[model samples]
Target chain A: MRTEEQANQAVEEYADLVRRLCFMRLKNREDSEDVFQTVFLKYLLYDGTFESAEHEKAWFIRITINSCKDSLRSVFRRRTLPLEVLSEEAAAVPEEHGALLEAVLSLPDHYKDAIYLFYYEGYSAVEIAEILGRKENTVYTWLSRGRALLRRRLGGDCL
Target chain B: MNQLQEALRGVAATQELKEWTRRRLVRERTRRRSAGRKGLAAAVCACLLCLLLGAGGYRFYMSPVSYISIDVNPSLELGLNAFDRVVQTVAYNDGGDEIAARLSLQNMPYQQAVDEVLSDQVFQSYAAQGNGVVFTVVSGDGARLQAGLEGCSGYYASGGHSYLADARCLDEAHTNGLSVGKYRAYLELSEYDPSVTVDDCHHMSMGELQQRLEQCHEGAQSTQGHGHGEHRHGHS
Candidate 1:
């Protein structure tokens, strides 16, 4: 039974990570916004007790990714905006790292997601596979391919 | 692209969705709390029902609703737990403990239970004085146990709720082939005679009473050793 204060603290801590993960998966603001609300709502109502804070954090990450995937497969999935238009048109990244965000966003969908989780979230290939519900070898292949793509965009061995 | 980490980390949940999620969470928590309360109440009710049933069963098991009380030198009461089971066979007097040990009547049915008790060698020892056994049978159900006592009815009459019936009557009735009930009814209406000792007449039947009168005449003619007039005096 999480108290209101505890739920608020959780929202404060994980909201950004979940929001960015949603944006990465959806690549469109409207769909991302739907998943953002959905994931946090799920967190607040989770019946199981977590063993530790890390376990709780991992659970939130897994649910956010799964919720994004579910929204993509939902009945409302057909009504979609252009992924290219959103990436080029949405320039909400801060001035300090505008170029990097734009480059990361420009990578292929699978490659970009794998790269984001591996680099930014500090997850190993095995852990990313578990969260994404993919095979470990597949996650490793995605990371390898994604890093090669990011190297081309960075004009250096970014790995 | 290390700055990409900073860029992504700085991203926040939109203000509208945060408010919506919080409001929905509050509503969900309230619903869950109510369901939990209902479950707790149901569990409490079930426990109370179990306890109520348990107490009722215990009360029914312990109550002494029906039994046969046989009182002799050491008066005793045999309690029935069920229709065919003797749950408690205890003595009510001081010598009761000693007499009760000889009784192999526990768990026996009503018909055979009494006969088994009376036949106990130790019980017979206690009744050597012929302080005839007293029997009082009772049942809450409208069942009268007087009939169908079989071979025992001849020796033991349908005594009052409690009656002192001579033990010797059992032997006498056995010898004369008489039912104890018919014999006692006859004795109640017979005349006393000097030939029969007063002690034996305590339970002597009326048929036996007539025999005593005939013996009185025979003794006067036959026995000159004791004066016939003195024998008559003794009888009087």
Candidate 2:
């Protein structure tokens, strides 16, 4: 188990990354908060040592993604929130990127993950494959298909 | 920066979320540590209870509740626990010590221990030379003493006599450095002849004690008969 100081450090360092992953995967602010808290609690209880900063960050990413998936699969969570509620949640960000955030959230789950890792987190296709436990070729395919979908959704050569 | 990166950068964790998660983690770590300490305390309590019960059981099993004294020329005694198993052996004389040295009677059943003593080569040789053997069961519990006498009589019915006695005299018997059987015989012989002492009787064999007791009874009877005849003749 991690000491209190170590746990606080981890929460401070990975809060933004875990929050982004949860927001991308769960969409609902309440469910994202739940997964966010769960991911840090898991970090506190995790006993293994990390090889490097990258390894530690990868561990946090994997745990956060899995936690979000678990939250989405919960039987008690409402499957489809009202559009007004989604709009209210989406209003948390700047108004200029509302369309872009909606476009990203509306993408297929695998494409959203591939695109976020590629464009936002700056992870290579091979590194994403290692983090997501996928074949390198499969990740390359997802990246290609994800970019095409994003181009169509945004209606420009934004890529 | 790409538009997607620019857009996603705006979606970051708030300060409230990080502070809330850190507080909850501290609480969870405290709760888990408390539970671990409780589990360890419970394990230690269980071990102590087992040790206490084991020690109590050993004491009960080793405490003697009855005694069986076998006296031929060698006066030896076996102390039995509640289960009728011998838990102690004592020798009262040099002959008794010699016989005790030749047998392993501890933890044997009283009846089996009697059989072993009666069947010993030295005891058999004494019996063969016309010495009388006596088996005495002494206990505060009458039923147990009766049962012990009956059990031992089966082993040496032909050559030995079986008797039951109270355990109250055991301390006095021990004080005089004698087995209960010898002490009992000493009591009877002292009654017949007040001059008899434990030291004198301690060295006497069971056969010699019995012989002296019979002679005392015979002398008392004859003297009473002769006095009655003299009184009747004077009255006539």
Candidate 3:
């Protein structure tokens, strides 16, 4: 059981871990915020107890993904927008980087999340699988598929 | 190296997460304390009264006030100052590092108002998002005022300049010249009651404090009157 002080510290130290996980899974900035809040509030209320930092990090990832799933379920009834390009307004993309972000956003949610976590966050495929509650092969498949999709969308030989 | 990574380098998480976390922790502490008490009859009355006021078109529960606070994680503090601009999901600290945020809301009916602010597209586009906030409704006089760091209740703020701090909800104590403190009844999750007994307990001149209380009461009551005025044809 983590003490209040340690719990506070844990939240502070690994907040980015939480953000990265949410960013990968949800794609949209707004839904990501909703999931992020739900994750921390749950951590504070019931799941603050963790045996190790790794344990806490894994827990945050799992909860964040689940929260995204919950939001996805809710979106069945409520009109939902893609997380990458918000429907409320046009994203102000500079002429240079807009195409690249749009390509990343076009991938399936699972593929997009896996690719970002693996390449950007430097998580091993095994670790990504563990956080995502999937097998190693699944993570590999997502990464491969996501990269192919990004390559195709960007129409570049870079892989 | 990847496009996503390149995008993220320029995509900044906002700085307001610190404020959200601070407010959340304090509100969490307050809610836990309130639930420990047994007498919730008055609280139920207050909720009913507010609901009736809303029904009558008083708009008592739809106040636009919001409370915000920032807390820097020692580890994340270094990177906070790098953020370029403020977005709904992003805020930049003074030192220029970025961190995620969490929010604690003391009022439930006002979630719509808060959602309006949080859901803005400019605010929503950033990837560095804060955790979901806990919203609880408490009754009180002041809306947004700087609170002392320790207690979760509202104190008798004397001057005009209240810091732009995370304001807790205060309850009106009808007896003892309307005691100033956090309202206990409106919490879902809490750490402790936000009520604190001041040292100069006797310093509260009943007349002066009562006048203040009456002003607040009249304000709420006047709002209630307006709400009822809206429903005059419906009820009759």
Which residue segments of model 1 deviate by more than 4 Å? A75-78, A82-85, B14-17, B31-236
Q: Which rank order by DockQ, best down to worst? A: 2, 1, 3
Q: What digit string (tens of lDDT, one per residue) describes model 3 on residues A106-142?
A: 5566676787778777889988876664567878998
Predictions: Cα RMSD each = 43.4, 40.5, 23.7
DockQ for candidate 3: 0.05
TM-score of chain A of 3: 0.76
TM-score of chain B of 1: 0.39
**Which candidate tops TM-score?**
2
CA displacement after TM-score superposition, residue B107 of candidate 1 (Å): 46
Between 1 and 2, whose DockQ is larger? 2
lDDT by residue (tens digit), candidate 2, B1-236 = 98877777777888998899889989988987896688578646655774788976566667888887888777888898866788989998787888889999888877778778877888777765544576667776533343334334323232454455566667788898888987877776676577888989877887788678656544543443233422111110
> After superposing candidate 3, which stretches have Cα over 4 Å from the reference?
A1-4, A25-30, A80-95, A157-159, B1-3, B36-236
Residue-level lDDT of model 3, residues B1-236, one tens digit each, is 76556655544333476346545755764665465343265546656886777754334333333322221110111000111111122222321122233432223222232343334343233212311211222222112111111011111111011111112332232132211221111110011112324322234322232233334433433343333432111111
Give per-residue lDDT, candidate 1, residue B103.
Answer: 66
lDDT of 2 at B49: 70
Q: Name every residue pair that clashes in candidate 2.
A: none
